[model samples]
Target chain A: MAASVRTIAVIGFDALQLYSITELIRRENDYVILDTLDEQCDIDSIDAFIITPSEFVSRFDLFLTKRTKTLILADKVSSVGMDMSVSVVAINSRLSEIEEAISVLLNSAECGAISNSELSARERDVLKEIASGKIIKEVADTLNISVNTVLTHRKNISAKLGIRSVSGLSVYALMNGIIK
Target chain B: MTLFNINSKLCDIIFYDSSVISVINRFGINLGVGDYTVAEICRSHNLDENFLIVIINTFLNEKYFPERLLKTYSITKIVNYLEKTNSYYEQFQLPNIERHFNLLIMKSNADDGNLHLLKRFFDEMKNELLFRINFDRQEWFPQLLQLGNTTLDEDIELDNIPESAHPIEDKLNDLKSFFIIHLKGKYDVNLCQAVVSSIIALEKDLKQNNRIRERILLPFERALTE
Candidate 1:
């Protein structure tokens, strides 16, 4: 499997606002802008969404409850229902503030306390190897398993943990002492 | 002049053009005291007076650096002074040149594909320099400083590039050739000239570092280990 870079989508931004925001985030190497709300977007792969209050209507279900982190503008924060986990920034926040919000949201998930009682011993071995920077073929070679088995184990791990990126998994391993 | 053989109080080095500061700044000797002359500043800092004269003349004429004269002064001292000049150049000049060069290539009638590739090459070169200098400041310089203060005393200066595991001369030549091969008729004349000046400045820095590594650091480290 390829390394995962988190995808962020900006919703409800006018053309001028979209350009400036995209320009700011463009400097960061870790992020990839999936698309603006102007066209059909890949909602399934989106790791996070940046939406204004008026535009939150387009992805109301996402705003309410989704495993993915959502960044809501300040003006729209008041209208959001209780019992939701979302980061809020000022209506006219600077680039630094947006960066802070994104970092906090990305790190907020407690992957350090991952529960893997369901994973088989072989799956656990594959997880540890991949998290330690081994590719699928290397993991298979190291464990004396077929490459197909390694791919199956990776898919199962992503499905179970809902964590996709290599960086994210690397952090999880470090935090949980799965890797040094 | 042995600090007193000539009249120093009324020298004309600083009185002509305000831009003369570019020449005078090479000494890293400042006029901190309101009533001091260039002689007094140089004497206090232990700088070579003859070398200062040559540097100032070169700066005034907009000529390339006098590479042969580098051997006459304390190489570490010259490296320290040139490193400061490099800082000032990066802060005040690099961005302006990059922006102007980019705008020129964008508006030119040259082959857009090759021009764009050249632009990317230029950007990569600039980024490599900026990142390398930053790493030196953040990691290598600090480590050297700690070693200097702890044991070497007057023997080690922060700008002293140590006897590295690699050759410094090859790196210097590589930097020079990168500029020569890329910066030419393809670029606007002013842009080419500005980039050449930048390359020369970078060369002076590496050359001084190489001198220090060979002259002072290698012997000093060998003695310490022995």
Candidate 2:
């Protein structure tokens, strides 16, 4: 049997904001766009409800959980309900981070895994070097920073992502298109 | 009586306007003259305007004729003067020397279009050698040998044409080697035939290279065969 065409509805008032997100996640094979504000426009057939954090929190619900995965394109965690829904977190208007967030949301939906968060630039630099199998000292010398500084970034990366090992960092990087 | 007669004749010749007198003393016929106009002078001189112009054009190129004076002289008069002065003679340099050879190459008689650039190459190489070899006569052979090293020197910062491999002494050897190596470098041909063909081609190519070689690639056949 032929597969169904996956449809996605982008929800945003700002054209620029929508442009940024669409530009990032525009390459996905199984997606189409629908209106973001059309709430009752058949949530049953939709695979994911991607909501802006501001929009999602305003319509926050407890029982309105788990028809499809819910993702919030948010800068900070604002609302909490008892039921589990994924949050695609980005940081202070970082464009690259926002792109990573959309890609992570799409991947998580495919694998039925947890949502991923944005990486800081230093964390990304350290992860890239670490992924290349360079030792901490070598990465430090190349980056022109102290080894302790690299260690600090690694720790921050681990704490932020809940991944402890460098191998885990490599796996995360590969999965999310972080390092080549 | 004879001494007194000689002095009297000399004074008469010097003092009076003998423009009317048809008097000849020695080797040549002297045309007794009267100044009227240039047209009259030319007519009395039996000169053609057009023919005299060509003669002036040709003789004006003689090194001895001051250019300003040549332009001022009626072409016919200049031609007349030039003929009398035997100004068309060529000064020959040493026959076997390179400069003399270059002069021969430059002259119209030696140019066969095919041999023109070989002539130019000889001239350029001679000039370069003269300028480069600057010391007294003793330094001649050594300086010639020194300039023969055409390899790029560290002192030269710009891109330079690779030096001709054939130094004066080893030109024949270098030509032979060039023939051997490049004869069939591009196409398949027997060594002897290819050598002959490539040398002919390379000679032509080197000539055209100065004018338009940068803009267009000349065909191997034209350089070689014709």
Candidate 3:
């Protein structure tokens, strides 16, 4: 199954480099690239920022870029320097490394939404309880369902989502807002 | 250290430090399981003895975290433990502080305006601290536990979680200067120190939580990825 489209903005990458990153993301069809961080672009709505060293002037710029999902390109030592806030990558050239970096960042970004079209209400409850760290018996007790019924719901949820492990379900639950 | 021989009661962990009752509560080990040895009670509850020991140690001594010892525990367990610690503040400690703080305000024998300001600022700071904690409980901790679990087991990798915001630390420092130091110059040195200690203790608890996350849990998670 495809992930929900991630909206990304590229800043300070030269035209050729910008084309490469956006092309890579769009080829996957999992990301929608905006031309620039413009007035139409809600600062909060922008999912990730891939900014190059030449463009990286201040923390203020990235602070304005987005909150959580930022990838800074560093050649030697960028203006952001050793600041532990935003991720600073050493490679400025390789598109594959760039793609891998972007994927890792996006995956870890805490931004991205999951659609809830397929999940039933019961499945949603089970997901939330499991994700919030409740064990199966505890979840059964809380929901006032039979333990076997809770197990059945969990199995159905895993089958529908193709995510079997409790940890995987937990990630799905969090990403999909099945749990707070 | 509280010893637990076969004849010893299971409740000594709580008896040693009443706060520890909250920690064990996260493991669903209810109080008053009489005279069961530590090993016996752990077996009865099906709680891993080593895991329980590490949790108790982490709660008692913030600096004593052994990341490898903590590896057996799951993300859910750690999150629950941290959440319980967070709750201890607003549920028990913060209310106790507020009660005495009200008494201090009522018994103010001085004509100073800063005392009144201190009362108001203290209330706001407590609210802000609580609000930040609630925000973490709802948003940050869920994502964090997922991140820890993901990076630990799968090929997926996540960066270190950004440190949480503690705006109240600055507020508490301001209180120290405006109210506590001022009180020392005025009449009640003991009262000033007592309230200051409360603020310091709360700050310490929050900081220790941050340390446990950063030091023990994150390292353990990273090691799993490795």
Per-model TM-score, in order, reads 0.34, 0.26, 0.43
- Per-residue accuracy of model 3 over B1-226 as CA lDDT, tens digit each: 4433334455766677665665666567877878676678888888777667766666667556556545456777777777877787878667766876776766667664446656766787788778967987998677667665532333234356666554566566555544432342253656666676677666656665666677655655555546
Ten consecutive residues with minimal summed lDDT in candidate 1 chain B?
Answer: B1-10
RMSD of 1: 25.3
Candidate 3 docks at the CAPRI level of: incorrect
Q: Compared with the real two-chain complex, what DockQ does model 2 have?
A: 0.00
lDDT of 3 by residue, A56-119 (tens): 5654565543454566776753343243235665554446545555654554332235422366
Q: Per-residue lDDT tens digits of candidate 1, residues A61-88? A: 8667664556666552343223335555
Return the lDDT, model 3, position A30.
64
Residue range A13-32, candidate 2, lDDT tens digits: 37776775566666655576
Candidate number that wins on TM-score, 1 or 2: 1
lDDT of 2 by residue, B8-42 (tens): 23223323423112111110223443433323433
Q: How do these models rank on lDDT, best leading?
A: 3, 1, 2
Each prediction's Cα RMSD? Answer: 25.3, 35.6, 20.7
Task: Give the range where candidate 3 chain B is weakest over 10 consecutive residues by summed lDDT.
Answer: B149-158
The true-versus-predicted C-alpha distance at residue B218 of model 2, in Å, is 96
TM-score of the second chain for every model: 0.51, 0.19, 0.66
Once fitted onto the true fold, the runs of candidate 3 whose alpha carbons sit more than 4 angstroms away are A1-180, B1-37, B40-48, B145-182, B185-197, B216-226
Tell me which residue pairs clash in candidate 1.
none
lDDT of model 1 at position A96:
55
